[model samples]
Target: MKLNTIAALMALAGICSVGVAAELAEDPEAIRLRIGTGDPVAGKAKSESELCQGCHGEEGVSNVVGVPNLAAQFAPYLIKQLSDFRTQSRRHRIMNAMAEGLSETDLPDIAAYFASRSRPKEDGAGGPDANAKDLFLYGDVERNLDACASCHESDARGRVSRGVAYPALAGQQSGYLRVQLLNWKAGIRNNSPQGVMNRVASQLTEAEISELANYLSGL
Candidate 1:
């Protein structure tokens, strides 16, 4: 499906008042039982068997417009996303379908496989506005904007936090990050159950959003 179409569908899904009851019941143990925190070698075999290469690229460096580059993504993040996809906690028709068949054992192998591969150099092509840089470094507390450095770090190198999912943003394409931000604003990507990102994105103006994307891309 076209990326725009997928985005629109996700938006609709988010706004549809349908309670995601099915997704909430996802079996965490199923994934745990399968993955078992095993070695990356086993993860590689699972990735191959699951045809992850088809969309995620041969080594998880996806070239597709909407699909993210998984190469160099933290293993825990990958595992969480996989588990969410499988359980319907994260709702994406295509991803849900893809993840549905995976056993718990499959996730570790996939996570390890992508983690073991080298992260490709990002082709970031953008410049940041001075105001955007200021916002990133020192948030406008009066406006209730939090500093990006608090979670993503001053360098934007992701750091893990307990009970929170912090994804690496450094070296990621700016356009991709912008798209994701827009998705969060539009409620298309509901990764945060507590709606932190939704609230944050809602407060940002179009220009600020553009500037932030540009700034992160150049980082």
Candidate 2:
């Protein structure tokens, strides 16, 4: 069991290192493949009329637990998520209901509007616990765990290149992070890149999940 865990961590560390130094540099192919030209103006209008602001704030910062803040998220990521909810590939009772009825044309606009919004200012809460910080900066090699910074970066802002599906963790709701981590652990969520989260999270205890969530929320 220990060997298997180490092997998984070693494999993931390799996967996450692809273009680590250049992860933020835009790839033209990625742009074309992920997001076509979207009309932010139309998206704004559509979002307002659709009552999207009720849950996701007018500016895209969501106050609701388990609801993610969409502001400043990569447009294509948001588009993919909405489409996934529509197709039931990623299920959320509320999101499925909201997404299922949207027309194919409605997706791009809505994603664009949220992407155009700036993220809400962070509270500057503080730092991570020692254990959490170690996990984030340097994974437990004995357990074969890869560092979170391998993909999400030290600031927890995430990587967007090479079809990587990492999400920005900084200032994200702690409850949301905790639930998602639990989902990954339990196999309830399976949408991440190369199923990396599934493997990485399976190694974490529930207490570690909570500790990581609390640390990331303050970033």
Q: How close is candidate 1 to the true structure, as a TM-score?
A: 0.74
Top model number, TM-score: 2
**TM-scores for candidates 1 onward, in order:** 0.74, 0.77
Residue-level error in angstroms, candidate 2, position 200: 1.1
Candidate 1 lDDT over 1-219, as tens digits, reads 232332233234341112212211343332232223544555666777788888778767677766777754666777788888988877888989989998877776677556544544467555657897788788788999888777677866554567454666665666677887887888887876477778777777877887887787666
lDDT of 1: 0.64
lDDT of 2 by residue, 10-129 (tens): 234342122311321344333232223465556767888888878988778887767877765666678788888988988889889999888887888787666545444346543649
- Which 10 successive residues of model 1 have the least lDDT summed? 15-24
Alpha carbon lDDT of residue 61, candidate 1?
69
RMSD vs true structure, all candidates? 14.0, 12.0
Superposed model 1: Cα runs more than 4 Å off:
1-38
Q: Rate the local accuracy (lDDT) of all candidates.
A: 0.64, 0.71
